[model samples]
Target chain A: MTSSFLWTLRSFKHFVNGSSICQAGPVEKRGRGRRPAAQVRGEILDAAGKLLLDEGMGAFTIERVAAEAGASKTTIYKWWASKGALALDGYFHAVESTLAFPDTGDIERDLLTQIRAFARLLTRTRAGRVIAELIGQAQTDEDLAAALLEHYSGPRRQLAVAAMERARERGELAAGVDFEVVVDQLWGACYHRLLLPNLPITEKFATSLVRNVLRGIRA
Target chain B: MTSSFLWTLRSFKHFVNGSSICQAGPVEKRGRGRRPAAQVRGEILDAAGKLLLDEGMGAFTIERVAAEAGASKTTIYKWWASKGALALDGYFHAVESTLAFPDTGDIERDLLTQIRAFARLLTRTRAGRVIAELIGQAQTDEDLAAALLEHYSGPRRQLAVAAMERARERGELAAGVDFEVVVDQLWGACYHRLLLPNLPITEKFATSLVRNVLRGIRA
Candidate 1:
């Protein structure tokens, strides 16, 4: 894979509008061995995510992903710049719904809902394994690291940070609260446990973690 | 490396009394090719740390470590069960000193001190690179993950957790505070940045992070 991920407008817009999410584009041709382009796109992403999560990155290969995806190798190459790039996007696509930030009006409760969903994803799903691999690999993999920041972590944090800022504006949080750190504490704690696993990252732990942060920052 | 790490009393005690801090053990032997066991042991650890930090775990081999440390390959195998085991110990040996918890009586201040020190290590030293590699590799390397929990993250966290508990007892924190979550928010947020550097994890950030958690829990 190349050092930088090629971010198309659709990919970049995922954070702000989630438009990069796979939906069937218009299909004009129905021929032998041909599937809808968007359907194939979604399958390729699923294949990449499952390979990385279930089999680990050591076993990840573009060819294997193509075979599992039932998509032409050309199609995989047509989109992603590199395997690392695909993995970053594929991983985000696989897990983003579980972490979607809710706007429940009450900032504390909204955070709790999201955080608990995250804890469950980490505690119970393959998404946790996928994340562990992505994060673990990011330490040394510069391409993957850069793409993750640009495509995933940066955008994801902004969404949560903006949400908290809204909460602050609504008089639900202290005026001086650094929402970035608040997001860090809330989401980063789940990641710490996911990577470290010294302490359980349970739904119960999620409850207390959110409560403590809210306790610290509530207006 | 084997699945399980061989931890002797000296190794396990490092987290508790830090007696594993390499000292020149009683060694009278100085033959043509022989060195004091303790001195060689100390050198071996330093070499292992340097190898992992500079070259990464992929390049880490007992033979290479022996060549670098001037310790015998047999000596390397005798003490540690696997490469993962050695890397874990070497990493902790390299970093534990910098993360030492200060007992300055004021809970908030002590946290700021340690968190700032950790930020410096992560932000300034090769220690951060070593940690990133260790944590990143831990995703799929089961052996490394287990040993890190047993040797490093678990014991290290206990020391910090106990310190916070003492603060609560002293009426410095609210009785209802979950010190574990408090610890999670403060340290986990830093790790969040370390693994995913969307924001600058500076000493300034450390100061603000500690302030927020203390604001939440301070009695």
Candidate 2:
């Protein structure tokens, strides 16, 4: 009976020890030194984006971002020259990761795919909210506006223009059709619908838009 | 010589008095007691919108708005239950003044007219910035979101729908076309372009959009 009781106590101690180990594992690992550079950069951007989304542009201070990212403020300032630069980098990264241009070889299909993807991204993410804040801040901050235009608008537009050019090259475009104008129309309609909130963006609307734009430009 | 000096001094006195009058006129009038309700209401909304555009939603406090409007805090709170209520009123006023729908007899022409008007207003005014801000803020603030839909999106959509219906009644619309869907496409493109900078909301693009939409929807 004494031997059995001792054995039971030993088993209970082992169980308790095992449970404690499991519970303490994550906590003990919490302070593991600096993450890899790429990971640290990504984490910093994510925190900055969350700050921008939650508290507006004014809350996107370098110190706040660094604290949220679990990195030193000196580390962030070393990588980015200013808060605006950091914010711009974060904005650009968020947009690139989420909104990709479609190049399905058929202009109509490609455009439809692109528009729908963009509409979904804009409607469903904190990125959309961040964009609106950036736009508002842009009115007063010329440098930030220029950065947005360069990093966000410029690359996306070049992709769109290239896609339209490909359509023209493939003999899919009508004679005298302005490719730039067509691209603008497609992009404009998509942006307006997403931003205005006057109506929900439905798949049917996307189909009609693609059909209409293709009709306007098809050879 | 005495007469000339006296006249010069009198002129200087008059200039000083006029400057004081110009500076003090609004303050003196405000101090005289209650302003007309309609006038005060308009002033309050204008003040709120200015603050919203300049400083985003964060700066839109009762104290700030009341001070800017030159009205008592009690008067402002009497009309608006909260800052959000005041913001809603301000948003509607700003949007309505700048983005009224066209009613030209030709549906294509009218739609083009409205799109161009919206493009120009959004590009040029603080109204556009404010609208974008409100939309972003609405994503987080459910009350503001509902209020915006009820007051702004609902009315504007009704106007667009009415315009489409008028076209249908006039037999200008194709029998199988969905009017609501077409309007959404047209306006969506326009809104999308406005948010993206440096992309020309050009006359050429506008014409192509109308022509394309008409192609898809015309009887």
Candidate 3:
């Protein structure tokens, strides 16, 4: 996390408590705590994520996360408004590398590859279960829902949407096809299964979702 | 609310405590309590739905529902494995009538109408917020997730799917197209908004989603 990163967090009304999650300026923190806000946020997220994967959401708490991250609870709370926010960010931090959008220059193949990797992240890792917990809890937790839109799902969708926009720019997509809706058709389908449990999330399913989607929207 | 209704409740292992939620059978309850299990279930559900709509899920509780319905917590628990179960059933029971599929012989128009009406139920009523809470809470509660799949979302999807399948049989849909994914694409998009809070659910959005899908999958 950097100053650039703080921009996204700033947009979330519940997040960025008092201008920054950190009560101290970077120089002031260095003078006292020695660790910058970025460093503390990073450590908290890392610990929060590891704990989430190792034990799941039931065991996740601010106090435990603080102890694990070797930071104080005040510091952690300064950055994240609630456990749901932390869990989403932590889970996103943990899985971001594996879920990066691929630019293979072929829209269909790129989407399939990305969706397949995402499907694997959900099925093969604890990421799936953790996300299920975050989403489920977000129903009542307004802060978490806002963080999800601002910090997590919103950014995730932007990445996928950006990838599709690139495809459209390359003339591979039909004119006037709403890329966002196409995204909802593809990744939203995976999330539908994740939240509902009616359908299975698998590489095969991801492939079919992407392929079936392309068959409809391809130029 | 009947024996046939009991069949769906039975499939959920968490539900149907000791072969039935009601301790006494219809005859037994009739002799002693003067209410059949179906009638009791109906009353509980009615009370549950009323509370959920009037006060939302926070005000909803097994004890409260029991008191409101003039039943006992034990009775409510017998039929519902958990509050999640009760909430979903209560919500579905409350909203099922307005969401029925129309058989206008036009698959596209029918889908648009259904999705539009469903969107209205979400936007114009409390169903949207209640469902968001149900889906959010379902993440941690396996029993709720199972109940949602078996009782609510599963049955709801079947109605839309059955309607689409009829469209397929009538030579109105593409033969190889998967109706399930199509459902995911349509309603799932609305659900995506409900859960994520990024998009708004509206009659216009539903119509666009339905029209876009039919453009791809129509025969």
Candidate with top TM-score is 1
Per-residue error for B205 in candidate 1, Å, reads 1.0
lDDT of 1 by residue, A1-219 (tens): 212222222243343244345455533233455678787888888888777656655577789998888776776777665676576667677677557889978887898898888888776656787667767777866765776787778888898889888887787788776788878888998888888888888777899887776666222
Highest lDDT model number: 1
Write candidate 1's Cα lDDT for B1-219 as tens digits.
212222222244343344444454543233456677777787778888777656665677888988888666766766665565576667676677667899988887898899999888787766676667667777767766776677777887888889988887787777766667766788878888999998888878898888777675222
- 2 against 3, candidate with superior lDDT: 3
Docking class for model 3 is acceptable
Full ranking by lDDT: 1, 3, 2
| Cα displacement (Å) at residue A78, model 1 | 8.1
Q: What's the alpha carbon RMSD for model 1?
A: 7.5
| DockQ of candidate 3 compared with the true complex | 0.29
Q: Chain B TM-score for each model?
A: 0.70, 0.65, 0.70
Clashes of 3: 2
lDDT of 2: 0.60
TM-score of the B chain in model 3? Answer: 0.70
Those runs of model 3 whose alpha carbons end farther than 4 Å from true positions after fitting are A1-90, A217-219, B1-90, B217-219
Instruction: State in Å the error of residue A159, model 2.
Output: 0.7
Model 3 C-alpha lDDT per residue in residues A139-186, reported as the tens digit of each score = 756665677677678888899888878887887776776667766777
Better of 1 and 2 by TM-score: 1
Model 1 chain A, TM-score vs. native: 0.70
**Candidate 1 segments whose C-alpha is farther than 4 A from its true place:** A1-90, A217-219, B1-91, B217-219
Tell me candidate 3's interface RMSD.
Answer: 4.1
